[model samples]
Target: MNKDDAELARFNALARDFWDPKGPMKPLHMLNPLRIDWIENQYGSLVDAEVLDIGCGGGLAAEAMAARGAVVTGLDGADKLLKAAQLHADDHQIQVDYQLGMAEDWAAANPGRYELVTCLEMLEHVPDPESVIAAISHALAPGGTAVLSTLNRTARGFLLGIVAAEYLLKWVEPGTHTYRKFIKPSELAEMCRRHGLEIKAVTGVRLNPLRALQPQPFELTQNDLAVNYFMSVRKPL
Candidate 1:
């Protein structure tokens, strides 16, 4: 199989475990609340908004958005993951339209449609990030907001996200990430600018254990130290 097919197969294998609260993705489970807060605060309100979750693995983020009263559509390229997302949504009785297709391709088919577009933790995995950014820009309605979260390309990011998170803690599957694919904040901001989206807010993600411990935070202030950066951009009105 080719590289894309191989990657899809690997992700499909992990689809079932992605939403298990007590499974290997404890970190994702723990950070879900925080991510929801971030997304909500950045985008203002999702109530009655038409939202799109690109690469909505297991429909976690989409479900969260739906809980906030948004009409959500979860899109993923992997068939197994999309099926899992659909099943999860069905079991929860939350309505989310899960579609199987590449983000760029899907966006191209339905342009200027969504009020809020979220492409979290997925851009770096694509072969052409610029094209993906352009697609996201096209998919957003005038004055719409798009939030993207991805790893930064730096020594700190590589050491933390890949070396520590993936290799040391075994948080994610081995070979799930590649340092070379990581993108820096400036690169992402510039891409947004080129795609007719203005970068509004850029923040870092912090992970913590639910205990009496200081929060281990990732700061987006310094581009070189930000392991993961969350960006909020908007299409011109």
Candidate 2:
């Protein structure tokens, strides 16, 4: 199989346990509360807004956004994950549109449609990060805001995200992460700028030892390029 096929296969394999609270992804599950809080603090209330979640695996963040009163649409390239998200949403009686497609493809098909677009923990897995960013830009309304979270290319990030999380804690599957695909904050920021989005805020996300088993609130720091960073960008008004 080619690169895309291989990645999709990995995601498919993980889909069964993606939403299981006791699964390998429990660490990410634990981070849900903190992620939701950070997203709310950055975007304010999503009440009555149209929100798009790119690469929204298992609908964790998407459901959080929906709970906050936004019309949430979750998109993913993995079919099994999308199916799981749909089932989970149905089980909760919450409405979310789960689409099976790449971020760029969906964005191209529906331009200037979303008030808020979120691409979290996904850029590293894609083949063309810039194209994905461009799609995100196209999907947002002129004044829309985009929130992104991803690992950085640094010793700290590698050690924490790959070594500690994957190897030590077993938070994810083995070989699920590759250091070469990791991106730097500068590169992400530049991609956003090139796609007609202005970088509004760049904040580092920390993992507290106490809350290491669960998601804790991320403090805004001047140190944007860290182990993990959350960035808020906006298209011009």
Best by lDDT: 2
TM-scores across all candidates?
Answer: 0.90, 0.93
Q: What is the lDDT of residue 38 in candidate 1?
A: 82
Residue by residue across 1-237, what tens digits does model 2's lDDT show? 112777778888888888887686676677677677777777789898899999898899999889889999999888998898899889999899998887777887999999999988888887778888999999999989999988899998899889988889887888787888888999999999998999988878777667555444244466546788888999998
Q: How many steric overlaps are in each model, in order? A: 0, 2
Q: Write the per-residue lDDT of candidate 1 for residues 6-101, one digit (tens) a residue.
A: 667878897889788656655566667767788898888889999989878788899999989999999888888888888888888999988888
Error of 1 at 25 (Å): 2.9
Q: What is the alpha-carbon lDDT of model 2 when measured against the actual structure?
A: 0.84
- Backbone clashes (count) for model 1: 0
* Candidate 1 accuracy as TM-score: 0.90
Q: Give candidate 2 misplaced runs (Cα > 4 Å).
A: 1-3, 210-224
